[model samples]
Target: MKIQLASSEADIERCYPIVARWREIEKRSQFVRQIQEQQKFGYYFVYLEDDRIEAIAGFHIIQTLARGRVLYLDDWIGETSEYTSGYSRILFDWLMDYAREHSCQSLRLNSSVRNIQAHQFYFKNKMKIEAFQFSISV
Candidate 1:
């Protein structure tokens, strides 16, 4: 399995549905624009198994006074199939290496409280819960 940047329309078409399983986007045209917007702040990557996409994630590297250099993952969703476990491990291990190589002090991400599968994965992977994520619509 390989993790590659998803930058083309075809790539987005293949991966967006998987992400949509977790976050609702009202329309495909809207999703395309959002992908462009996201590229300004983060990156979208897809995990591939024999030329087919199996997982997708968005992540950004930023410097903050509180955390120094950190890797912030915005989205991570895998095909809810039998191969999910292997795909997840490949993606996460890659991210771990990326964070370390970039000199990031931490890898942080926010998951909806109801996402039990992700929460459990975080726990098993030894990530600590430091604070709640709060947000409001503009």
Candidate 2:
């Protein structure tokens, strides 16, 4: 297995399968380009095994009064059936390791309140319900 920040257009192409589960694939290349080039805020990382992308994480570092320096996990997805598997845990552990290496005070991600399964997974990973998130489309 190999894990690294996804850098090339080809890398983004390879990421399509895992990410397409949540978003439209036709728009993916453009989105990946924006994240890799236009945004100064984040990086997209991919986990590959036997040359196939099995997971992807999009994260950024941010400083806020409440959290100090933190790792903001904007997106994460793996093989749908692998959600509760050891592979998912491996990916998550990797993300946490990244936070520690970067000196981030906290690592956070917002899951939709309706995602009960994901909530359970978060709880299983020892994360607490610290705050509720609210959002509105602009």
Candidate 3:
């Protein structure tokens, strides 16, 4: 019922498996290091209720010429058992409020083309599919 920054090892540990499952990360230590390094550019937060973590969200606030200030979410992984409705909405609402408070003009994220569940949630929250991203690995 509360969202808190996942900074300490203990905090990260609680949500590691959920994130690992979604991202296919193989090592806990590697995830820790990645999160640490990413903190310079973004933040990871955990949703908790009764001392149990139910979701993890990774995001960054950036200034863009196209969108002005935007809240870009890199990940929003929730426990499968609670991912369908209430819990996901709680975190989503919190992020929306966070974006507004930070003076962001938009909240955006890119989900894999295969993640139907996430797309459903996004659409339900009134987000639109505005563009297709093109990229190639170097």
Candidate number with greatest lDDT: 3
Candidate 3 residue-wise lDDT, 28-105, digit = tens = 888887887888666656555445667878888999898899989988877765558478888888898999999999
What tens-digit string does per-residue lDDT give for candidate 1 at 22-128? 67887777777788788876665644554666787788899999889998998787877523467777788888888999899999999788877777778878988
- Would you list the clashing residue pairs of candidate 1? none
Model 3 Cα shift for residue 84 (angstroms) = 1.6
Candidate 2 or 1, higher TM-score = 2
Worst 10 residues of 2 by lDDT: 41-50
**Candidate with the larger lDDT of 1 and 3:** 3
Global lDDT of model 1 = 0.77
- What TM-score, computed on C-alpha atoms, does each candidate reach? 0.85, 0.87, 0.90
Runs in model 2 lying further than 4 Å from the true structure: 48-51
Which of the two candidates, 2 or 3, achieves a greater TM-score against the reference? 3
